[model samples]
Target: MKNKQLTFFLMAALFLIPMQVKAEQVNLYAAGSLRAALGDVAKAFEAEIGNQVATEFGPSGLLRQRIEQGEAAHVFASANMEHPQNLVGQGQKGPVALFTRNNLCALAQPGQTVTTATLLDVMLDPAVRVGTSTPKADPSGDYAFELFGKADQLKSGSTAILTAKALLLTGGPDSPKAPEGRNLYAWVMDEQKADVFLTYCTNAVLAKKELSGLQIISIAPELSVGADYGLLVLDGASQEAWRLALFILSPEGQKILGDYGFVVGGLPAKP
Candidate 1:
């Protein structure tokens, strides 16, 4: 009888030990471009750490604005360093880390006559409707305008011409929402919003997958702009949030980002 009671008590304590390791929840706000990749990363983290990750995806700039406005979040991943750096300037925390990289690309409608060499002329064509996200509200748009600035270096007055003619089609509060489970760039092209849209290469790849035959044209080096993604943990966040940040910079997480066509380079050695 004594032996049986001791065995039962040990079993009960063993079961209760697992319960004592209470799971934590990490709130994450990230750039819309990271939706697929980060979703996978979050799943992997949850499985490994037994913690819940609540994610919100949107334009990086707008997400930063929300965080600045007192919305509680554990981590923030921005498309460009500027937005996260802005938070650091405001005393968010230290050591804003670069997690991934992306490059500008042109997503052309099906059968559009465009290529790396001819991309400039095709975009310059007065009849071609060029689309861009809202500058300052999204880093993709800022990169698009930066590409335009490079174009000016190649051909005088190109910036004025491109910026003046470009259509702000997405990444704004007033922008039309894409259909459920539809890629915004693909849907915009399907709706005939523009003949050519300037966006991230990763976005172009996803758009092409969604809308078959949509062309993903690489920008020439002269006009190419690369985006640096930044990762930040807010001051006073749970340790689980920092763990999520480290997981994103881990080899597994970077592999997931690379598999999604993002340029994963220059990452710090994993600790």
Candidate 2:
């Protein structure tokens, strides 16, 4: 009888341990804009969960398109809120969770005469060249257009000039016709191309030295120019993925997001 009781206890413990362990894996796809920050978060999350968090980083819009195309991602963390909302609207995502926010800035090449105050001057300068990603392919690119449009309203023809200055892309690595990462600012950054490239605040955080020794110029706040990072569990993901999603949104989970430069917020309480 004693031996039988010990055997039963050991069997139950073995079953529960794996169950507890399996409850923590989260597979995630995130935007390239958040990559530098999220890497830290992913590490911390894994340490706590004793499970893995697999992440794929790319342009937000491209990541969203992949999810829509039936890629088996368990969670989607976008640099902008639109991708999550679009997924929700299409019935691909669940309840929306706004996790963080970010600001925008202009990137310029080294030795450039343009200051942020002088950014408009350069934008309007026929001698200087500007580049940006395409609106549809990149949210940053889209935000660039919107910001330029606002600039036009603030001044005159600012939109046209900014758009005109961009290199504009049509696809990312997944696109067969354009199987490459779209770095709108790549040429300018490498000294192979343009004089100015518009990029995000976090990009400034991660690539300050490489981005043409660029400094930000102030733009008006009302330019429809903010990014809200969001996360949502994917449909048809494994149970492990769903558990990981929950873990990321938990307080300990959200704390990790801060390390990655995400403006943290608690996940919405279950309805």
Candidate 3:
């Protein structure tokens, strides 16, 4: 009789386990630059749970606007902390968790002579056609603008000159097209539109993979800028949302992000 009772309890425990597993489908909004990295990470999450993680990707600010407009999303993964922190401040979300960091680089074709020790000197060059994303719409662009602001402090009037000369060429759908894993700046270079593109290091890495001879130039250390990618599970979201957030901060997720060229926990202070 005791043996029979043990078997029955074992069966009940097995049945109860599935009930604890979150089975609700989840919606995920993310920054476009995360495409290669997060795609695999989301698949890993899906493999662990039968629930689906439907994702939408775009410029981080635009994604933030969508979330603010009452768009239904269980979680948001952004290119920077400001958007996630904004939601947290509004009580629309929980505490922001930073997962990774990315630094800016200039993409140029081989022999383009694009690497200047200082980004200010590069942008300050009247002859160098520089390209940047639209500020306030993309975190990458915001980083670029921050660097420009720094340039202003360093040289008094450098910011105005850089901003005026920059070709605001990519980031959103409305921006001119290059290839999708695109360095529109490079595309412009290919077409002679611009000399160099200011973009995430990872994007420049991907661009180099597609087209050989694409050179990545470092942003001068003095004016270096970094992007902090943040994650948040919206308040009252399904349990799966938090699960995905935790999974992204897990070692496996960090590895995936590292593989894609992001600094796992932010870059070493620009030495």
Candidate 4:
């Protein structure tokens, strides 16, 4: 009887030890645009792996700066390849996988007459306010500027005109802060910060969802720019960090991103 009781106690202790060791903390820094989608993805990942994911979201460029300044992020998901690639150049040991893609769109307030066909004309109108994120601090801004460059090809001097007139509204250090749980683009438009805002299609979609009557107009193919999102796992990161990266590239992860309106082309096959 004594021997049997000792064996049962040992088994109970073993079970409790596995339970205590099962959950590890994963530090994830990701683009602000990915908040909704990644929030769900993190929940799913946690359920599957029994690991806790501590997430932080902000402009991809700003997040990259934080990581470079030694903020101790295990995984970094950027809205553009350039920022993560810059980390690779800094000896972060990366192949910098392209995890998702986004496209530029015009988020116009209600009553604005803008369409793919006449986006350039409306943006160039002197009375119209065109808002964009801060370039070098947000990939959305870079893509918007790229769109402006494309516009120049369609209409002479468009790049100079648009760039000069574009308002650095969001993603800047001094940009107006959105209220808690508010969509930045939606809040900006609601506040009449800009008559027309150039942002990601995903952002525009969420903004429109948050603020009814907002218009999401696709940029004409001739003047459109694609944003390539990159995922990187820094050197010396825990295995959980690498696991999270792979999970993001997995079919399940790709589906979540697709549902959020990101381009999931060239993703891995479902297993």
Ranking by TM-score: 4, 1, 3, 2
Against the reference, the lDDT scores of all candidates come to 0.92, 0.69, 0.82, 0.91
| Pairs of residues at least 3 apart in sequence or in different chains that clash in candidate 2 | 37-260
Model 1 CA RMSD to the hidden true structure, in angstroms? 4.0
Return the number of clashes found in candidate 3. 0
lDDT per residue (tens digit) for residues 1-271 in model 3: 9999999999999887856654788888998789779988999889986778898878888889888899998889999999989988887747888899999988875767655565567667788888888788889999988888888767989888887788888776588776665555446667766677888999888777767787888877778899999998998897778888888888778888999999995333445
Model 1 segments more than 4 A misplaced: 1-19, 266-271
Candidate 2 off by > 4 Å: 1-25, 169-188, 209-212, 218-224, 238-243, 246-262, 265-271
RMSD of each: 4.0, 5.3, 4.9, 3.4
User: Rank order by lDDT, top first?
Assistant: 1, 4, 3, 2
Tell me, by lDDT, which candidate is best: 1
Candidate 4 residues lying further than 4 Å off, grouped into runs, are 1-22, 266-271
lDDT of candidate 1 over 93-166, digit per residue (tens) = 65799999999999998879989999988888999999999989899999999999889887888889999999
Report the lDDT tens digits of candidate 2 across residue range 1-271: 9999999999988887845334445668987777756766677667775668878987888888888888878889887778888898997748877777876776666667765566777777887776665576667777777778888666787778767766653235433232254333443455545566666766654555444455555554555477777778877777766666676677766766665455677745668
Candidate 3 TM-score to native: 0.84
